[model samples]
Target: MSKKILISVVGPTAIGKTKLAIELANHFNAEIISADSRQFFKEMQIGTAAPNSQELASAPHHFIHHKSIHENYSVGDFEKEAIALLSHLFAKNDYVVMVGGSGLYSDVITKGLDKFPNVSPDIRKNLNEILKKEGIGPLQRQLKVLDEKSSNSIDLANPHRLIRALEVSIGSGKPYSSFLNKDKEKRPFKTITIGLQADRSIIYDRINKRVEIMIDKGMVEEAKKLYPHRILNALQTVGYKELFRYLDGEWDLEFAISEIKKNTRRFAKRQLTWYRKNQDIIWFDFNMSKADVFQKIDKEIITVQNE
Candidate 1:
């Protein structure tokens, strides 16, 4: 039998990846698996730019709002579940489309996660204490010194990610990034990555506009609903975090909105940094017509399957 194909739609946030994935899925009669970490939570639909009702109806989708914010979900858990879902999907369709801006989550499907040495629980406890007392600055600086690559690519604003990287680097006496992609498990399906990108200025402009749209669509209200649960890892993302600060009275709404746009731009840049290293993604300008992208993807699918 011919190898099945997994077509990944990846790029920075607000870049039309979901639209493209739906079109691809429709054309191929395939299903979509969302690798976006934020979209997993049911409460974060507006903030995460999750597919709307029409989009969900256009394609069969998995892993979108399938978990609650209160659940303790990890990348390892996602890997197990997604791999099993792929097995079921491949048995029915020749192509399966996975779409998301969360590069780490996407990588777990394409390249299996690397295992790191266990660190003492006290290390995490100390890091949490530092975060609570001094804020995320000290931990960020520590990761910057210990694993510069991870510091550059991962979400620096997330205290959980910072602590995880720092603990691994501190305990193993090796840069946390050094352990990544070291044991990529083979998958039965052939994988093809499609990246949508544009100039930095254009990307930033899109992010700004999207943030404004989200605010108009009641993202502030959504954030308010989730604010009581701000400590949840799911709420630590860009849009809600900024709104949480606004709700905290630390900054005015205007300033909070601006920070949301600014932080989202930074997140997009970090996403590009992570994906550029893969070298497998076939990139297209975000403005390219869907027809042209579909033509190119068809060629790539044929080429990948023949390899």
Candidate 2:
């Protein structure tokens, strides 16, 4: 049997993953599957930086703006849907490119998800109560003590993720991290991971510039349209949350924009930390030319095929 390759393009936000993925997909004659959680929402175009018309035209992309903000979408859901799509795509082509900065979503498509014992719904309910009453800090601190690795990798600001982790820890009497990298379901195809990276200073600058561009691209107006749906999990992201604060009179526009830039930089740092844990990734500088990147990916694919 022939082997299909899923070429995953992963990196921090604003690190040019989209550009690189398009080039790779076009060169390899493959379609692109997006694993970016924020980019999945149809209402979060500007803020999430969903591909522009031109970029989308460059190559066929899937899973972008495929869900509504009001819908309940989870990593598990993405995994199943993406795998289904890949099955169809792989039947027609041996190579498919997956791109996104979302580590867990990407892992579901590439490394497979970890299994966990069932936790009572009451546990999740109680955790939500705690989050509502006390905010995310207590849950974060608790997770840090119980599962430091999860705390490091998770988006601490996300109430849904924090509550899920806490419920598992409380119900199973074991840290969440203990459940990871175990019982990973094997996939039929092989994955070749390519990661983009840069110095901290360069990454931070790129994030800042991207935030400015988002704001200029009417991020505030976009957030306003979704402000009524602010309580949705999709709106809990960095750019929208900051602008929602501005709408709430918590901060002025300038201050809110600054907060967005700061939080985005922090998010990018966490993304880098997550990707660094995977030793299989072949890293490339963010500024590497497209031709050079294609050369590297070509070499990596050849190595995988020969093995």
Candidate 3:
């Protein structure tokens, strides 16, 4: 049996993943499967940077604007859906690309996700109550004592993950880390990972500029439309969270903007930390010529094809 090639473009925020992925998809006769967790929601186009109309038309993309903030979606579902899509795409094309900065989403597509025993609904309900009453700080404290390893990898700002880990730790009588295994699962296709990076100042400047562009594109209205649903997990993202504060009059507009910049810089650092820990990725400077990046991609493809 022949195997199709999977090319994954990943890096910190504002590192040009979308444009590069689209161009690479066109070159490799591939389609793009977006691995960004936030970009999945149709309501979050501006903040999540869902592919513009031109990029969507450039090469077929999947998992972009496929869900609503009101609906529930998780990494396990993403892994299943992405594998199914990869199988279908492989039937038609020789290569497929999955692109995003979301580490968990990327892991789902490239590495088969480990399934954990389900926690009781009642436990989840109580956890929610605790989160509502005590706030995320208490939950973070519990996680530190119960499953510090999981806390290190998962999103600390997310109430859903924190509560879920607590419930699992109590119900299953095992550390949440035990549920996350390092054992790799075999897949039908081979995935080659690419990382994009830039000088620290340049990347930070790009992030600041991107946030400004989002505002110019009516990000305020976008967040306003979803403000009523602010409690949802999807709205907890950096841009939305900061804007939510502004809508609540917790801080003035200027302060909210400053918080967005600070939070985004932190998010970018976290993303780089995740990617840097993985030895499989080949890093490219973001300032490199388009041709140079393509040449590196071509070399990887040739290596995979020969293997």
Full candidate order by lDDT, most accurate first: 1, 2, 3
Q: After superposition, how far is residue 254 of candidate 1 from its true place, in Å?
A: 0.9
**Cα shift from native, residue 43, model 1 (Å):** 1.1
Extract clashing residue pairs from model 1: none
Residue ranges of candidate 1 with Cα displaced over 4 Å = none
Off by over 4 Å in 2: none
For model 3, the superposed segments whose C-alpha errors exceed 4 Å read 182-184
Over 128-231, each residue of candidate 2 has an lDDT whose tens digit, in order, gives 78877987888999999989988887888888888888889989999998898877778989999989999999999999999999889999999999999997
Candidate 1, residue 257: CA error in Å? 0.5
> Native-vs-model 2 lDDT?
0.90
Clashes of each: 0, 0, 0
lDDT of the candidates, in the order given: 0.91, 0.90, 0.87
TM-score per prediction, in order, is: 0.95, 0.96, 0.96
